[model samples]
Target: MATPVLDKVEAESAASPYITVTMRIRRFNPEVSDAVVWEDFQIEIDPKERVLDALHKIKWDVDGTLTFRRSCAHGICGSDAMRINGKNRLACKTLIKDINPEKPITVEAIKGLTVLKDLVVDMEPFFQAYRDVMPFLVTKGNEPTRERLQTAEDRERFDDTTKCILCAACTSSCPVFWNDGQYFGPAAIVNAHRFIFDSRDEAGEQRLEILNDKDGVWRCRTTFNCTDACPRGIEVTKAIQEVKRALITRRF
Candidate 1:
């Protein structure tokens, strides 16, 4: 006969269950071959665990060679951005339970960037375009010892674009960026927008001039891909539109 303590232990164990998750990642290694390959990993994990955790288990326990980037796993660093289930997202921000575990979760490097290894990509070109836009405050004259004061309305003007963490999630998701590597991507334009509306920044016109080039805001077709792919909830398409309007109306 089963004792009462043994029956209670069995009941408690039955209350907790873990789901089997399958991750199919697209891998590339220049040292090995030009051809890409799909690798599958199966692990038992809690439904609420993040995709980054799954990748860690595979790298730590299954294969030490598997590669990816991650920092500040809570998702502020944006280091773990990748294509998950046909969409660009931060792996650290994506929860396994949010996406169905019944289907295999597909992970790949963000598009439009050259894959350097299994999940790492060549961010040089991405950063190169970023540098072209001058993503910084440009104020002339002597620096003020006191804080530059602005009205609350002025601060709110460009606050939406300020949430970007330079993750490249929006840029890589853009169809325009995928086709032309030279185009200044949405991330660049969004950064420009952040400073363009500032009441104190004196270089708004200069940044607008740089973006007025043929490869600038006009290239954006308003596909809404960048807006959807941004992990920080920034209104990317609206900011790009505002930049376009600023050119015509010359108003912030």
Candidate 2:
């Protein structure tokens, strides 16, 4: 039995699919220096593993000082959003094999926000924009004894917008947001859309009015970068267009 176990271990070792890949990371530590620098680390990892796994390897084995935010390793938490290979993506969802591993993979923090540390950015401004849109379903009058009812068609009206995980990938990818931090961004608009089209929500007019601000929906340039960056495959640009149409016609 001991010999069989040893043989199995040897066979697994021989079948290892590890490859040497260089992870190019943008390093910034305000406590140490204001200047941002790019550092490269050569790591041995399986291509099928996630980029987050590489970061963990570098932080655990190479440099313990590496700092970034992550809650659930799964993509649902939306905490590990970052720039991978010049595009915004969830680190855990991006597989190393999917991106070209022959070249150095670049990792950095999302743009248009204050960088707190390596791969970490201040999300207060992002959240403030989200709050401005009033993402929660707003109702008037007394509380209902039962849940608000809606037709299947009514629910489908805003189903696409409801998939938003608030990852900020769609927002951070926008060039308008990159230049102007005041822009409410695609994620905020998508959240507003979720409530605006809901049949049971009575605050559609109010949310639309809020989004009609100078820094609101008009800032979108329709570059489709938001749609391309969304990991959830949400039609972000279309939703923005729908909001624009609603604004003009005053109809939901």
Candidate 3:
């Protein structure tokens, strides 16, 4: 009958064939206690959606309390880097379909940092180490009116290190950084390499001295985790190795 046909159409409209992904997000409130906890959210998602989209849905529709950082919705912001399923990844770039869609996704703040709220971590220490490396180009003579001329080969020497976005992706993934806060970390060393190889920069010796400290480049054990975790595809381990070689070869 017409009634039966209408009922069938209504049922089809009401049912969704897509998968519902469950996310278990870690929650923390420093004002309440030092102990952090987890809260689970169930969201109906399209297979093509990224994890950042899922987080946006949870924050907007499911719970207003849930919090995280993201910008540029693309991977460039690097603000939403976190422990996604036990690995560091930019939330915007991580697609849900790529992961085990049937299983729940576990999201947590990046390790080796103090949680500020739900997902935000204090980045002061990370920036402090970044500043310690003297990231800017230092020249001896007066500023040239035009661009300093350099051969293509000179520019290529430090090309790999200049790709860093200051996202802290490499720094947070380092095992040495997780255990020792004093260590200069990979991001700092990468920045140092940017200028160390520059033909115009005259501060290589000074930068090498800074990196030669106990908590500096010597702390890196060459685990290559930083290189693996870097979203920009920088050769982090190689830069650190270059700095180590420079320290050993430098004439004091």
Candidate 4:
């Protein structure tokens, strides 16, 4: 006969939702091989755990060589953005149970950027596009008298785009970005929208001129993929459209 404690432990174990999930990751290492390969990792984890937790297990216990980027696992850092099961998302923000662990979860580096390793990509190009948009407050005067001021109405105009963390999820999901790397992707336009609509920003016209270039805001296809891929719940495509409208009408 089993003891009471043993019976209770057995019952709890039986009710546990732990499952063996297969993570199919697309790997690439120019130093190791020129060809990209898909590697599968079978991990035993709780259904409610995060995908990042599975990756941690794989790296800690299964294979130390499994590479990926993550910081501030709470998702604020935006360093862990990647494609999971055909959709771009932050690995730390994605839950295993929500993504259906029964089937293999496919993970890969975000598209458009050149992959440096298993899941890391070269972000210099993305940052270059961001810098090209002049994503900053450009006031035409000396130091502000007492910090630029704005009314609630003015702040609300560009509040939606201010939540961007520069994860590159929206940019990599863009079809236009994938086809033509030169196209200023949705992330850049979204950042531009934040400052372009600001009542205190004086360089809105200059920024608009930069976006009016051939590979700028006009390249957006409005497929809404960037909006869907944003982990911050930002209406990304909407911001891009606002930028386009501002360029055409010269009104923020």
Against the true structure, what is each candidate's TM-score? 0.93, 0.93, 0.90, 0.93
Per-candidate alpha-carbon RMSD to the true structure? 3.9, 3.6, 5.5, 3.6
Error of 3 at 190 (Å): 0.6
Q: Over all chains combined, what TM-score does candidate 3 have?
A: 0.90
lDDT of 1: 0.91
For candidate 3, write residues 91-152 as lDDT tens digits: 88889999887898999999898889988999899999989989988888788999999999
How good is model 2 by TM-score? 0.93
Q: What is the lDDT, from 0 to 100, of the residue 10 in candidate 2?
A: 88
Best of the two (3, 4) by lDDT: 4
lDDT of each: 0.91, 0.94, 0.89, 0.92
In the predicted model 3, the residue pairs found to clash are none
**Residue pairs clashing, model 2:** none
> Cα deviation in Å at residue 94, candidate 4?
0.7
lDDT of 4 by residue, 1-252 (tens): 999999999998889678999999999988899999999999999978898999899999998988899989998999999999999999998999999898999999999999899999999999999999898888886886687888999999999999999999999999999996999899899999999999999899899899999999998888999999999999998998888888777643
Candidate 2 lDDT, tens digit per residue, 110-170?
9888999999999999999999988897788998899888999999999999999988998
Error of 3 at 8 (Å): 22
